[model samples]
Target chain A: MKEDYKIERVKERINYIEDVLASVAAGDIDARINSEVEDDLSGIEAAIDLLIDDLTDELKQRKKMQKEVEEKLAKIQEQQKTIFQQQSDLLELSSPVSKVWDNVLILPVIGTLDSQRTQIMMENLLEKIVETGCTISILDITGVPTVDTQVANHLLKTVTAARLLGTECIISGISPAIAQTIVHLGIDLSSINTKATLQDAMIYAMKQNQLSENVKLHSLFADSDENEE
Target chain B: MLQLTTDSNWTELGKYIIKTEHDIVQVRQLIRVHAKEMNMGIIDQTRVTTAVSELLRNMYNYGGGGEVLVETGVVDDKNALIITCADEGSGIEDLDLAMSDGYTSGMGMGYGLPGAKRLVDRFEIKSEKNIGTTVRVMKWR
Candidate 1:
């Protein structure tokens, strides 16, 4: 009968659809198609295939994008590293801040505190004190961000290293959070002098500063060379 | 969703760290741009940036020095991100000890891994003796 033939065709299409889904589940994305075979149910199968194709394309795009991103990121990170190095080098080359009175040295650290900058600060502070023949160093960190255990440690390290150099280091302008963090971390900074402000540290430094007679080569670099010429 | 898989080659030795200093503003700006390009939502962006900053600090400090990688994706209908940090110098001998808070290897305060791990939904760390180390972070939308 004509009705029996139509039902058989519909059943055949359904079987085809089931096979398509199995293929998709197996990760064979290219196995489906949008063919019109004049069956009563092929249309629905076609629609599902189209949808799967769309999702597949989108996934591909995303993967490509992720790959591109990884490449660009690697490049940027590389560039930034060079930048960090150059900055530290520059900091090393520059003069460490100094106090004219008592020949004390002051280094004002502003902005956020990280271990690297702290390390650089310590190095610069020591080198400058040594270069200037100062016995006192003042670190003014009023403009720094809140402290954490790491940052506090760097500060302590700076003080300890300075002491090894036979120099007295003063830390001034401790914010509330910083003080709290130090206490929370239980780091003992008892050895370093503390001041409420830079002005205070400077005043303290002036009183303690005494130049060695050996360092009094008044014209150490002799601009007098030009004068003689 | 983000997944962490071990890979040794990610650590780039012989590469220098170009520090811009506390140029926090500049560093933050670059991170934001990266987040947007990855199609991250505002909250996720903030978290990723913070985690990245923490990792960056580590690389800047104990990394002996190397590069960082951040990858974003979608899995199971969830938007996800994976941030990876690599270091090529002498890797940490005791990862668990290093990850412990306040257990700094140097005179440093040592919050790099712990702080970075805290910022993400999932965290994994892998390091080989004298080879390199990689810290992977994952978060979902």
Candidate 2:
């Protein structure tokens, strides 16, 4: 009868282990087997509980690590986005396209002339020309540090694109270094009008405007005089 | 419009849409972050970013804008950052001539593609006439 009682107790412990295993398989990591039962099954129950605890801890650690990585990545991305935007805004501010006079727009370009900046400069110039309907646009690159062949080509393309829109682009503020670079690169600026300084370009543009106005006035007077005759 | 074979260990860093000239700057920023993650030097970072700027500019101008996928994966047992740009605009009819320096269909400097190719360690371009164009570039760490 005592042996029979032990068998019954062992069967009960086995049943408990099966139930705990079922709970675990159902995604319950908190389930634990009874370890107080006085039998060999007690040792088995203790081992199974220890296994569950280890597995749970491992899973928790993995999840925490994954979350930390995601958060760090997000923070870095946000910081980078803001920095990039700030730099872009600074570039826009540096490449200011302003209408200094009637029918004339001036774009004062400063700093390094990367392809990206040159592209922005081109777009800003084009949009300004369209907005102000300026006939003459002056690109003053006095503050530019250096010019590579690609940068010179970008400038040439900008002038050509502006011409296509019926706006004559005058490139001024050619420093000695830039001139030397242009010569070394064998870039032809003869087809496009260029000036030494921003002041010279402005004066030339004003004079041309005055000349055209005078011609228009003279034609009007000539037509009136002919009518009077 | 473009797809890369998935590796179990590959991780996507970011994805950006190139729709305007300003977006090029954003692409540079994205690349900078990934390059930094890979511990790339300043010069290599600049070179890769310059290539990205040119390629993105081409996407905006010729491809009518598209999307770029940036990811980190193993190439030849070395960690690499791969960038792929795809567009569904009017495709390049003459791929060879288009890739050549001083060839342009619009009011561009005509040096964008060739210059970009020179800047990257690995560059590949595929296009179908009237279909689209896709460019892939990789910088290894």
Candidate 3:
């Protein structure tokens, strides 16, 4: 009778261990089989060992999936950052012209001009001159070091666009080397106002401003004195 | 319209393509100066050199030796720059695994090709088993 009782207990323990394994396979790592050896329950322990082996396989698969998902998310984030940088460069390249002084708008080109940036620059310069009602615009390139044929074409586009808006664009700060390069390339800036330096461009703008102001002031004083007479 | 032209600036990098970690600094400095002299923006310059570093790292680690052809200046009414990198190492066996993130044939954090593509406007690649690999990267101003 005792032998039969022990066998029944062993069977019950084996069932409990099976339940634990099911939970573990369903992704519950905390599940543990609580089976005690009551009068030689070797069968129950052997079954428990089998369960542990299966659980190990399940855990590894889950970990692999997690790692793959994480890697994918990281790559996506890196691509987003790149797209953001390009957009930012695009926005900055577009001129944010505020005011026109003495019928002249000065657009300072700084930083490098990639193809996209160059396209945006040409569009911005043309738009600003028309919007601001300026007849003359000076492109100061002191910050610009050199130009390739492609970049030179963009600059030419800027000049042409400005002319379409009935504004003449002045390109200033032609470093001696750049001037020689332009000459060697056989591209002419003769249609555009070329200045030796930014200082020259600024001086020219100031002179235009003063001359216009003097005329306006003179007319104002003449009208007042005539009224007094 | 895109036009093609040769730039003397290409002469400065010499014959050796960036092939190792030790070479990264020189590659970066040259890229920075070339980009700066070309008037490439601060941010583009940063992305570009960082990308170049990653590419050169792969070349050095895998190929052990290689050459890079760098073209700076504008192309076709656009400020254009192109860098072509090639290496004669034991070529990639499983390109599928190679391109996949985290599936590096070498070590940890395999994010080379993906990162390079992200940094520039255009990126292209050609590779073969037992031959070598070549990557062309371009960024316009």
Candidate 4:
């Protein structure tokens, strides 16, 4: 009778372990086999609890690493955004559009020409023309290093836009390299007035502006003479 | 290991370590000078220089920076300009897919390989899995 009671106690402990394992399998990480009952089952319970601890630690570590990587990526993205902003600002400052002469706007472009900077340049030029109502504009590319097909297209567009606003645009400072690139790209610059240097374009603009002024003066004098007569 | 196709009498025009955007610019300028010396004409100089720019950028962007060697040599008894870029980065898994136009693994226009090919007179690429990649291009004078 005493041996039978001992066997029954062992079975009860086995059933307890089975129940705890089931709970753990059902996603209860907190479930643990009671190891106080010193028996063969106690050793199994200790091993299982140790396994759960290791798995929990590993999962926590992975989560921490994931968060750290995500934070670093976000920081990199923010830095990139700031750098781009600074680049565009530099482009804007480099390609300053201003009314350097009375009734004449001048935009001196330096550095390499890309699509983005060209777009910015066009916008800035158009804005100045509208703001100052200048009838003559000069685009000086003396400092520009290279001009690709897209950049040439942007220049054409800028000239066209200026013409729509009743402004005559003159392009100057075509370096040999740029001239070669334009020819290789087969761009048609025949309609646009081009000069070898900014000084040349400025001289042309001055001559045109002064001729119109002289014409206006002559008309005004003629009107006064007619009134007197 | 890289094998040279030409004899050892090649004149080293320039060598560049491409790591950043500024380095790419330097490479382009260097090639332009060399191309000018070879009398490749202004248009061809621009084309080859642009090709170098694209290739160097690919090495920096995809290969995490690499070494580029520019040499002037004789090919088929004619003056030739040879450019080679080698990198110890993850090798391309699918070279065909990478060479195809508009096949981009990252945020790029996917014109590096094929565009460079189009700009040069001859192009070749050698890559091994986990070993690295090397690109060679030649332009005749």
Tens-digit per-residue lDDT, A94-164, candidate 2? 77899998889998888667667878888999999999998999999887644544566778889999999
Arrange candidates by DockQ, descending: 4, 1, 2, 3
Candidate order by decreasing TM-score: 4, 2, 3, 1
Sort the predicted structures by lDDT, highest score first: 2, 4, 3, 1
Candidate 4 segments exceeding 4 Å error: A1-30, A37-41, A70-95, A110-120, A142-146, A210-229, B1-45, B48-141
Q: Which ten residues in a row have the lowest lDDT in candidate 1 chain A?
A: A209-218
TM-score of each: 0.43, 0.51, 0.45, 0.56
Q: Across residues A109-189, which tens digit of lDDT does each residue of candidate 3 receive?
A: 875554556667777777777777887788887776444333465687778888888876788987765565455434556
Between candidates 1 and 3, which one is better according to DockQ? Answer: 1
Count backbone overlaps in model 3. 11
DockQ-based CAPRI category assigned to the predicted complex of candidate 2: incorrect
What tens-digit string does per-residue lDDT give for candidate 1 at B1-141? 122464433332122232543543345446656666667766556556666666666665666545556556654456565566677767778888988876887656666567657656788787777777777777775
- Model 1 preserves the real interface contacts to a fraction of 0.13
Can you tell me the CAPRI class of model 3? incorrect
lDDT of 4 by residue, B1-141 (tens): 344465687888877888876676677788889888889887788778767766776777778888999998987787899999887778788999988876778755565677678778888898877777889888999
Candidate 3's interface RMSD, please? 15.3
DockQ of each model against the real complex? 0.09, 0.09, 0.04, 0.11
